[model samples]
Target: MNLLWLAVMILALSIGIFLFSLRWIRRWIREDIQRRQAASGKLNAIFEWAERGRQDSLRGLVLPGADLRGADLGPGQEGEPGADLSYSNLRGANLRSVNLRNTNLEGTNLEKANLRGANLKGANLRNANLKRADLTSANLRDADLRGADLKGADLWLTSYNSGTRWPDGFKPPMEAIRMEEE
Candidate 1:
């Protein structure tokens, strides 16, 4: 009778431990799934119009702190294939390593956007509002910034060349470094 009692107690403890571990594992798995789903939803929303070759206007759009690395908004203009994101609101968005090459962003509101390490080569940003935007280490070679409102923008260690056109009479910030190669 004593031996049987000891065996039952040990089995109960083992079962309890197993059950606790299973619950912990399930909780973590659920959290991970939720995170992935949210990220996927944001990515899909940004790329849906671009992939479908739709030239829809993304004006006044709001998407802050979103991970938009290597994304292409579209090639600007009606004749070409791509979406027009003029006057869109992308404050505080994470645009690291994004591809805005040749895309038109005229009059777009990009205040406080994190454009670190972004690729904005040849992008048409005429009259765009880039106030206080963090553009550290970004590639701005050949980008057109005529009439762009770049007040208080951070351009430290950015890569730009002679082809990068600035707004009329807008002196570049002293921290903005020019690229050696044209």
Candidate 2:
């Protein structure tokens, strides 16, 4: 009887240890997966927040080297304000062909960013730093660029309508194209 009881006790201890080890392994795997997904630049969480119109949640967001091509973070339905990404630092970000129409980018730092084919129509870019950024083929129609730093920025083939505002005494680059208001 004593031997049988000892065996039962050992078996229970083993089962408990096994269950604890399994739980720990599962938790570790789940956390590792989350870290890998985020590190891979899959900004699904950011996209979900943007889709939900969580502007406050996106404040001062940092997404350097992120692939945000054709993202529509623009104004919502009529009368709803657009996303406000003021003062965010997105240096070296890949914003190629993104739809940022009617968005607010005031005081944002976009140095060395690749903004080729981006649509900034009606976007407010006041006091933004865009040094050495590529704006090739970007739409600046009706966009407000007052006080923006466009030094070394590539404006080749960039189109701007009459409503687009530039810094005082600033002239558009020769490669900039003028477009008719829509």
Candidate 3:
């Protein structure tokens, strides 16, 4: 009789532990799935907003791969492209592989963002902040940079084709010549 009682208690304890562990695992999995879904939703929202120019009225949104070709993005505008964007905030955004030709970005905030392999030919960037950003393989030909801050920014393997423009009366560095070889 005592042996039977002991066996029942052991079995109950084991089942209880198993149930607890299962719940914990399930919770973790659910949280992970939720995180992924949120990230995907944010990415989708950014694209959708760029297409329609309105989504929850998010101001100064960072849009990657947006075609701002001749879009008027001046001050007090709805974050239009290729307009005077001095003092505009764009921290930690992905502008990778974008065509920002002739866009004025003077004194803009672009900290810790990914501008990798982007085209900025003839764009103005005087007094812009680009700290800790990935400008690797990006084209800044003929763009203005008289007082731009590029501390800790990556320029590795950046691109620069012909007909590229520079800042006001400024010339590209000798290292920039390597882009021509590619």
Q: Which is the leading candidate under TM-score? A: 2
lDDT of each: 0.78, 0.85, 0.64
lDDT of 2 at 103: 77
Q: Across residues 1-30, which tens digit of lDDT does each residue of candidate 3 receive?
A: 999999999999999999999999999999
- Of models 1 and 2, which has the larger TM-score? 2
Candidate 1 contains a number of clashing pairs equal to 0
* Per-model TM-score on C-alpha atoms: 0.65, 0.73, 0.50
Model 3 spans > 4 angstroms off? 1-81, 160-182
lDDT per residue (tens digit) for residues 67-118 in model 2: 7777877766654556677788878988999878887899989999999999
Candidate order by TM-score, decreasing, is 2, 1, 3
What C-alpha lDDT does candidate 2 achieve relative to the native structure? 0.85
Write candidate 1's Cα lDDT for 1-182 as tens digits: 99999999999999999999999999999998887787678568668777656556655565655668777764645346344667776777788777676666778778888888887777778888899998998888888899988898999988888999999998777788888582
Q: lDDT at 149 for candidate 1?
A: 83
lDDT minimum window of 10 residues, candidate 1: 74-83
lDDT of 3 at 171: 45
